[model samples]
Target chain A: MPAIEVRNLVKRFGSIVAVNGISLEIEYGEIFALLGPNGAGKTTTISILATLLKPTSGEAKINGYDVVKEAAKVRQSIGIVFQDPSLDDRLTARENLDIHGRLYHMSREERQRRIEEVLEMVELLDRADSIVKTFSGGMRRRLEIARGLMHKPKVLFLDEPTLGLDPQTRRHIWEYVEKLRDEGVTVLLTTHYMEEADYLADRIAIIDAGKIVAEGSPSELKDSVGGDIIKIKCSDAENMLKKLVSNGYDAMLVDDEIVIKAKEAEKMIPKIFAIADEEIKSITYKEPSLEDVFIHYTGKVFRDEEVDEIEASKMKWRMRR
Target chain B: MEDEKMISDIYAIYLREILRLWRQKVRLVTMIMMPLLWLGVIGNAFNSVMNLPTQGDFLSFLTPGILVMTMVFTATISGITTVFDREFGFLKEMLVTPIKRESILIGKMLGGVTQAVLQGILILILAIFMGVKFSGAMSIPGMFLTMFLVSIAFVSLGLAVASKITSMEGFQMVMNFMIQPMIFLSGAFYPTTFLPDWLKIMVKINPLTYGVDAMRYFAIGVNEFNIIADLLILLIFSITMILIGGHFFRKS
Candidate 1:
């Protein structure tokens, strides 16, 4: 049986349909990612699977227990790290983990043993007694992840796990998530970063506007974009796109650049330069990224304006530190 | 087995509140100091100006009222923790757990009750030190009972309000609007009998009126309503508050 299942799950807040007919089936010991931009209902879908919100229609199950009818059982089997920081800042890391264990009905010995194990897993054992409020942002996120793993849940949901963290911390968190897979835990994560999904997810569902636009492995999704992407910075991108399309090349204009997809794109670059020698200023060819895949499926650029602003400030703050 | 898990869950939540309270040394100091100022400074100021129909000295008459006031203040504002938890995102951690929602509500209410009762005891001790008289050693347990009942009722009311309000500022506005009226109308500062008919109706409806009256009977050998009637009304009020608070908390 699948570790997690959702069948056309729908959630509506009055007139606004937050999650519209979403379906997924995640196997045991696999890491799945729901990749989307902000407001694409990634968090809403996770909330439903975590049993925090009831679906407006359809069904969801965790470890064979219905999310609506057998919610307690489902809760017992799943742990979640929410998008926002949820730790009790006044408490120490160990106390936070201990309380989480107690909430799940773990005994004294079990909580003690598990707290050490999870803290060590997150490399926070040395700071177990330190108050969460005193810790940095990355430390707090690690502690929250440790707390989520304290109960040995069958499935773990990580909502934007490394959002706003520095590059080093993001990589560290990614490593921890990767380690969870080896422990035979079914993991479902949501992320707006295409690179994060590409690097970590075994399978990804590209979501936009409350619907899954595409779903597959990272390579599979990228391969579906058809061929290598050649991005051109030219004098007139609009005229260049028209010229390239008239020449029977599959190309489109993205922002200020004209992108063309072709087999053996390196060889086609010279032929493209021959088509519009003066119009093309500079051209670069590379393997199609998940971003290209998103654009291919949704016909829109993948961007999170709010997250980008926050990320930029956080990056600047980290650089200052 | 299920019952054991639920009890453990409640205990865990209760322990978190206790831990948070213990860590906040400044808050603890201020909670005790506020009541001291009211009992020491306000009580003396009121003693020179006001005359009561019953009891010896205004300090003795004011002790029970101040005790109830201390508990009511601490209990009602204790729900601010809930608002902070919601704003800080810790509420999601508790809600996603396997335990029943009622356990979380009960645990929080009990935590608030514990803080209020502890503050009540401290104020009671301070009042005794300040030359206030009581009905003797046996009334201590009865006084505690009165404090407990009053604490539970107001804590539930506070939690009920907190559950509906997502912002701390909104909760503060509502609390300021509601708490002042409840305290003033409960006869905490004066005798309910001397009030006009309309004011008397407000006192009759305020649950803290019975709590303060019962506390007065236990502490100063004073009587307004029957002691049994006081306890009965407080009990009913607590249960009703719990039900209403539970309904709102579960919905939230």
Candidate 2:
């Protein structure tokens, strides 16, 4: 059996069908990415497979144990790092691991050893006894990741693992994630960051609105849209879209930029740049971003809206224990 | 497999919760205040205003009810912390673990109930100084038994309500809607005999009414309701509330 299997999974919250019917299978010892925007159901799908959620209909299995019937077995095999930070600020990093270890029934000696290993793995050994509340956002996130791994779960789920971190910490987590994969753990994560996915994912499934729009290796997904991407920056892309189509070129208008695919960037550069003329202040060319691919399939990434203050307010709590 | 893990996890989580609350300054204030307010303020204020039958004094008869009511309120509001955890993703963090989901609520219940009951017990002692007398009516052990039963039943009722509400604001609103109503309607502040007929009927449906009635009867020799009937009804109320709380906790 595949290491993880989700078949025709569905989840609903009252009138909101958060996850439509979707299916996926992941092999052992591979790092797979579920790429999507806020409401894409990637987190919902992972939650079901992690045994944290029950599917409205259909089935999910982890290491051959049914998520519904054999949820205990599924949970034993999987570790989840949620989209938000879950560390207890009051506890020291070591204490956090110790508490989780106790939950898994780890012996005193065994848990102590595991704490050292995890702290070292996250490169936080020096700060192991420090309170988590005092730690930086990046450090807290890493501690959460370390705590998730204390049980030695075979399948690991990272839901937006590097979210809300600076690029430096994001890179640091990416390296640790690489180390886990090298150790033969099946790692699954959801990200909107194209570079993060391209740098780490063995295969990526592009999800949107509770459905998989595309699934393949990074190169394969990019290749699916045809050739290397050529972006034409202009004051207005509306007139340019008409110009490119009238000229028999399939160019997609993405905001102020026109993205087109061609066999060779060298030859297509002139024709694409000609459409913009003096209107083009400058032009640069790269292969394609998962963002580009997202735009290729969907309309826009709307990255600005992703970080609105409304999403931040959702994180507030009561006594904050 | 899940059940065993859940039970053990509940124990661990409950222990942690109790430890945290014991360390909290504000929680310490509230737990002590609820009982102190009754013994020092409410009990003293109504010392001679309302004439009620008491074995020794009004404060003595009123102490047990306030103790149980405090436990009931504390236990019910315990879910508010869990709601805070849920809203902040701490509860979700605990739930996603391979451990039993039932353990989450169970741990909260155990810790919350323990604190509440202990608080009530502390108040019971203070009541002695407040002119309330214990005639050694029942053995020390029997008094312990009575306290245990009352605490468990009321605490369970609190957990049942807390688990159903999601937000802290919503939880507080519902607690006000249900708790004060239960308190007045159940004779936590006054005697059930003083209540009219229709209210007396509603009192029968409330676990607190039966719990306080049995508690008062345990302290004094009077019985507005049959002692045997009250004890049996308390057991029923305790079990049913536990089941209901467990259901909503799992739903959560």
Candidate 3:
């Protein structure tokens, strides 16, 4: 049996179905990614597996123990890094680790030993005594990961590990996660970043509207959608879109660029250029991306970049008294 | 299989919970000291300023009220920390840990309970120095037991409120709406004997009234209600809230 097996798991929060009867198995030691847009049930599904939320129906098991029935056992088996940072800024890292250790009934010596090991793993050994508030976003995320690893979990679930980070900080995190992959720990990660999912995950499930739209390896999902991507950039994209489709070619206007998906992009590109009498600016054939695959399945962008600016600004509100 | 420890398990978390209040030591100092002031400043302020009818003196009558109130505010305002933790994601971290979920509840409740007792007792000691007389006062052990039950009831109330709140804003809103009204309604500062007949019936239902009345009843031989009934009601409320609060808390 696989390390993590979710069978027809459905978690509904009132009227909204967060995990709409989705099911998949995460093999032991494999870095599997659940790729989805926000509110697509990725986090909800992860929460169920982590035993944070009980399913409305169906069952999920980790190492053969039911997540709902054997929650303590499931909790013992999995380490989860929630989307939010889960560290006390006032407390030193070592102290945080110690408390968690005590809760799990770890002896003083064993807890101390593991604390040192995890701190070193995240390369925060030097800063272990410092309060978490002093650490940067990337460092705090690393500590969150370290904290999750305090117990050697069978699977580590990271929900959008690099969602709100700079590219450089994100890359640093990517390398750290890669190190975990090498250590033979089965990693189940949810990510909005196409490249992050494609680069790290061995197998990927594309979920949308609380359901799995597609499931395969990175290359497989892209290839399953389009054999090759024929790229074309022109000033009159709308006109170009009309002419290409009128010529019976399956061409999609992706934001500013025109993507023509076909068996052979080399064969399709010349025909596309010949058909369009608009501003022929630039044309280059290229490989497909997870973004393209997502757009192929769902008409909208992978992440609605049009997130409400006001809702995003509320994180800085003075903590309630 | 042997290497799995929980998230950020630290000894300092308990210390940190203490220190979080310690940095704002004014609240801790004020929680206890304010009650002590009632024994001295307020106790004497009324001693000369106005004459209040009681069996012994106003200080003895007021002391138990202040002490129970001390515990009440200590437990009720503790919803603030719960709100703060929700904002900072500290509470969420504790919830998902593999260890017993009850530890998070226990650690937090114990801290609030400790703060309330130490603060209330500090004021009680101040009352002792102020020469406030105690007629029916039990031994030191009996006094400690009374404080424990009262403090536990208060802490349980705070836990109950903390568990349902999602955001700090919601927690604070509820705390302000529920906790303050509870404090004023519980006879923390005034005697319920002065209350109207209908209001007195509500006060009879209010656990704080029983706690304050009973605690004073023990300390200085005041009030007419059975002390055993008061203690039993408060104990039931404490246990019921702890179970309900702890249940919702683990899920949240």
Total clashing residue pairs per candidate?
Answer: 0, 1, 18
The ten-residue window of minimal lDDT in model 2 chain B covers B135-144
Give the per-residue lDDT of model 1 (tens digit) for A1-321: 999989999999999998899999999999999999988899999998888898999999899999999989999999999888889989999999999999988889999999999999999999999888889889988898888889999999999999888789999999999899777899999999888999999999999989999999999999999989999999988888888899999998878888889899989988988888556678899999999999888877887777688667755654443
lDDT of 3 by residue, A48-149 (tens): 888878899998988778999998888878888878777777778887777666666668789889999989988999999887767887888899888888
Q: For residues B146-187, could you state the per-residue lDDT of candidate 2 as single tens digits?
A: 667766665666666667766668777877888878887877
Rank order by DockQ, top first? Answer: 1, 2, 3
TM-score for all models, in order of appearance: 0.95, 0.86, 0.85
On the 0 to 100 scale, the lDDT of residue A52 in model 3 is 78
Best first by lDDT, ranked: 1, 2, 3
By TM-score, who's the top model here? 1
lDDT of 3 by residue, B1-252 (tens): 333332223332455578667656578668756765666787777766555655556666677777776667776667446766876777767666665555566667777777777777787777788786666656366567777877776676666676666566776677678766676777767777788998888777777777777777777777658878877886787778777767766666
Model 1 achieves a DockQ score of: 0.84
Q: By summed lDDT, which 10 consecutive residues of candidate 3 chain A come out lowest? A: A312-321
Better of 1 and 3 by lDDT: 1
Return the DockQ of model 3: 0.41
Q: Which is the leading candidate under DockQ? A: 1
Give each prediction's DockQ, rounded to 2 decimals: 0.84, 0.44, 0.41
Model 3 TM-score (B-chain only):
0.83
